[model samples]
Target: MIQRVIQFWRAINAHLSGSDFDFINIYLNKKEQNLFFAMRLYDQRHVLNVAYTARRLAQKDGGSINEKLLMKACLLHDVGRTAEDIFLFDKVFAVLLDKYLPKTAHKLAKYNNSRNRSFWKKRRHALFIYYHHAAIGAEKLQKIKLYDIAEIIKYHHAPPKYGDCRELIILRKADSLN
Candidate 1:
């Protein structure tokens, strides 16, 4: 509970202080830039942090890694979370509900997208995205034909049994670090 509160505070802080992401501009192409900018300010900060961590880990590993693709995967990993524009209170409520009344949480989140729903209903939609953003992000990436990055996003949260990709493992670690 305390950890979540701290995380919430950090997220709010990140939202307030926007990220420039100028350091990575040279690495990303125009399309990737568009995608990166589409995310909310808080998410963009988080993505940048993750990318930094991934880069450090890759350097430490000293293994052959496609740095560009690894960075792309890190950038777009949470893009699907932006599908619903969620506020801080909504996120807090969702986390609490998910932790305690899980069944109710699932029910509310599942029904959140009904037309002309209330604020709480919209919050439920945000919660749904929180739980399933990885898969959702992977789907979006697939549309852009970034199949390799899509696979990494799809399995970042819960890796497959035959996980042999070092980049995927590094991405997961970096995400957790942030």
Candidate 2:
């Protein structure tokens, strides 16, 4: 644990030099991230940064503006990385998860779309996000009911229909760049 802490601190310090340390400090305190997790978080932060950027760019391009869904998809795209103990396994499990249960995943992605919206309303988007976290986050999210948030996670990687969801496009552009 100590080694993990040291590793995490050094890695984050290197990767996130310009980050909002206030937010990072609070996040570290709240999540108690080990060094490994912290490092992973740095990577995720970059990914999300790109995703949100693309989202903004997409808005400029006349696509629908949905910051809530973009945030959900961008942030949670990598939450699943926590599942893999090995680097190669991460890709493998992700592929399998998508293949075995696409509808659930897509629905979960939509749920993620509603997370921010639900904050102001009663309609939660938990179920959508939950479906993709392999039953764990899904159940918890379902309990909390952030269907949009869950759906964002589920479908952010592969949104429903072929033409591409605006949020998914932004997320993909961000994922590619980040």
Candidate 3:
């Protein structure tokens, strides 16, 4: 699974870069390079689902967010999991709570409820790999001055309920399709 995911990531990166690593990819490599590499494995149809959904919702809602940006957020949302298991984020989250976050990051994990914990906690425990990663992803987008795109990242988890923009709606749909 790890190797297969790596191959998938390589294909997408090859498409995006058109040859090799870009300046941004290079910088990501320096920090969390594994996450950058892992992004290549994201399913493209799932990515397109986000764009298509965003387009559909945008017609009803308002403005359209960047399809590419939303897709990128969907693909990269779970990259943090690369640090934990390279295949799934839930195991990574558990490992983080047990060893890293409290000691290294000096933070304690807080969850919504037992049901939510059982739901999301078991899915991706060690990394910022789920809904919250949407917000985390939004922060990254904000750094690039794409706050609207960031909002898409922020709401991908909740969809129409919390998703305020067309792009976020798209992201949620794409994620759901996956």
- Give per-residue lDDT, candidate 3, residue 37: 60
Residue 2, candidate 1: how far off, in angstroms?
A: 4.2
- Per residue, candidate 3 scores C-alpha lDDT tens digits across 56-158 of 5655665646545554555444442333322333433444454545453223333333334555443433333432445655565566565655555566566
For each candidate in the order shown, give its overall lDDT on alpha carbons: 0.78, 0.47, 0.46
Q: Candidate 2, overall lDDT?
A: 0.47
Give the runs in model 3 whose Cα sits over 4 Å from its true position. 1-131
Regions more than 4 Å wrong, model 2:
1-14, 17-39, 87-144, 159-164
In model 1, the clashing pairs are none
Q: For residue 70, what is the lDDT in candidate 1?
A: 89
TM-score of each: 0.85, 0.47, 0.43
lDDT of 2 by residue, 35-140 (tens): 2143255545554466557666777778566775565445545554342222322333333445786665454443333223643121113323233443433233
Q: What total of clashing residue pairs does each candidate reach?
A: 0, 33, 14
lDDT of 1 by residue, 1-178 (tens): 7768777777888842323456557566777667777777778788888888999999999999999888888888887776245556766788899899998887777535556777666787787877787888888788888898889899888954574588898898999878
Which window of 10 residues has the lowest lDDT sum in candidate 3?
80-89
Top candidate by TM-score: 1
